[model samples]
Target: MIVGVTGGIGSGKSTVVNFFLELGNIAFYHADIEAKNIINSSVKVKTKIEAFFGKEAYKDNVLNKKYISNIVFHNPESLKQLNAIVHPEVKKHFKNFVNQHKNKEYILYENAILFETKSHHTCDFIISVYCDLKTRISRIKNRDNISENAILDRINNQWKEDKKLLQSNYLITNFAQIETKNQVNHIHNILTKKRKLI
Candidate 1:
């Protein structure tokens, strides 16, 4: 089975997924982190991004994240074009990763935009994490050290919570660490039992 965990910015999907990571027999794929790595390490990807976004896209072999984020967050077309360059490579990487770990109980695919990228279709189950708006905003502000407008821009780029919940097989309301970990343990037990019957 392939299980996915996703949520909007600051929704604590990472914190929840970390608990799942502690469980046995489940491989993990962190899409955004891999995508960033691919963009940084692959010469083909570097050339493509530089060609479209210009040399400013990178500085001394590292992605100029602020430069790219500023452009893509404000311009939908730029974001689409950027995804077009990076996603295919990440998909290929993920395919290899899944094959390597196919014998495991399941793969945990963690992504912030799993549904937006239509990657949820590849999952056997999905957990959507959510928190109150104020909590999310505060978390992002503290973690990312960005202004509210920039944080909201990232949030707005994602699908609404209502739509995500509609698509999810599980929902995790991540308000506190202990509560979140308990939910993860509950889900992990359920998934463990689920695999046995398969």
Candidate 2:
């Protein structure tokens, strides 16, 4: 089974993915991390990004993430262009990852923009991690060291959590660690049983 996990910025999606990891049977593919790797290592991606954003898109062959982020967050078109260039390659990489882990009962594909990119269509099930707006803003403020307004801008760029919630097969409330774990355990048990029937 392929499970897609997603949530907005600072919603503790990583924590939930980690809990899934701790269950010991799941293979995990973090799309954000893999996207960064593809952006840096794939010559085709690097060339396209350079063409779109100019030479400064990279510094000594490494991605100028801050420079890119500033441009994309403020300009929706530029962000869309960037995603257009990167997401397809990320999807290809994800396919290969799934092939490698085909023996696992299930694998987790975690992406912050799973729904926005329509990547969840590739999954057998989807999970959304949700937390209140106040908590999300505070968490991002502490974690990313960015201004609240800037964080809000990033958050606003993604689909609202309520919309994602309606589409998800499972929802995990992340405000409390204990509750989160319990929910993960319940989902894991359910998926394991489903996998057996498959």
Candidate 3:
């Protein structure tokens, strides 16, 4: 079975992914890693990005992420165009990954934008991690060392908790590790016993 964990920036999705990894029952796919690899590896995507933003999009085989982020975050249209180019490539790569793991009981598609690109449709269940707005901004500032405006901009781009909660089967408010562990364990029981995964 495939389960998805997604949330807005600084919502503690990564911590939840880590907790699942510690359980040894799931393989986690970090979409950011896959997206970056695709951008760097796919000739078609590379050409498109370079065409959209010029050679400045990359430097010496490395993505100029900050440069790209600054451009997209400031302009909604640019961000949409960028997502249109990258999301399909990332989804295709994810499909290939799913094909190889048919026998696995559970796998995770951890993405911050699961709903944005409709990737959650591919999963059997989804968990939306959440925290209040103040908490989220504080966490992002501390963890990523990003400015408040940048963090707020990213949060604005993500789906609101109200909408995500409606779509998600599970919701976790990760204020602490123990709380996260408990939520994951609950989901584990449901997946293993109730869902009858082998």
Candidate 4:
């Protein structure tokens, strides 16, 4: 089964994902990272991005992420256009990952925009991680040298936390490590048992 896990920027979703990784049986596909890999490695993707966004999209055959982020976060249409170019390739990459991990009882599909991209439809279960706006902002501040406005711009681009929670089958409210791991453990137990019955 493919289980999708998503949350907005700096919501500790990746931290929660790491807790899940501690469990022995699960396989993980990190969609965002894979997308970056695809962009760097695929000449076709690089060409298309450069064609649309101009040559500033890459430097020395590497993605200039700041240039792309500056373009996409503020302009929704540009973000959509970029997703159009990358997401199809990501889907193909994920299909191959699924095939490789076919024997695993569960594979975690980690995407920041799983629902936005409509990739959640492919998941058997969905998990959304939630953190308060203040906490999320603080977390992002530590991780990236970004202004709150810039962080909010990224957050605004995603579906709201409440909206995502309402749609999710599972939720991990991340505030503290001990409490967070408890939630993860609970879900891991449920999915593990779920796989057995299947």
lDDT for 158 (candidate 3) = 80
For all candidates in order, the CA lDDT equals: 0.92, 0.93, 0.87, 0.92
Model 1, which residues run further than 4 Å from truth? none
> Clash pairs of candidate 1?
none
Most lDDT-accurate candidate: 2
Off by over 4 Å in 2: none
lDDT (Cα, tens digit) per residue for candidate 2, span 1-198: 899999999999999999989996789999999999999999999999999999999998999988998999999899999999999999999999999998897999999999888899999999999999999999998888999889988998899989999999999999889999999999999999988888
Query: Between candidates 2 and 3, which one is better according to lDDT?
Result: 2
Off by over 4 Å in 4: none
TM-scores of all candidate predictions against the true structure: 0.96, 0.97, 0.94, 0.97
> Would you list the clashing residue pairs of candidate 2?
none
Residue range 47-161, candidate 1, lDDT tens digits: 9999999999999999999999999999988998998899889888998999899799889999899988888988889999999899999999999899999999988888999
Cα RMSDs, all models: 1.1, 0.9, 1.5, 1.0
Candidate 3 overall Cα lDDT vs. reference?
0.87
Q: Candidate 4, overall lDDT?
A: 0.92
* Candidate 1 vs candidate 3, lDDT winner: 1
Across 1-198, the per-residue lDDT of candidate 3 in tens digits comes to: 889999888889888988888775567788988998889988899999999988999988777999999998889888888889999989888888888877666888999999988888898899999888899899988988999999988888888889999999999889988988999888877876744744
Q: So what's the TM-score on candidate 2?
A: 0.97
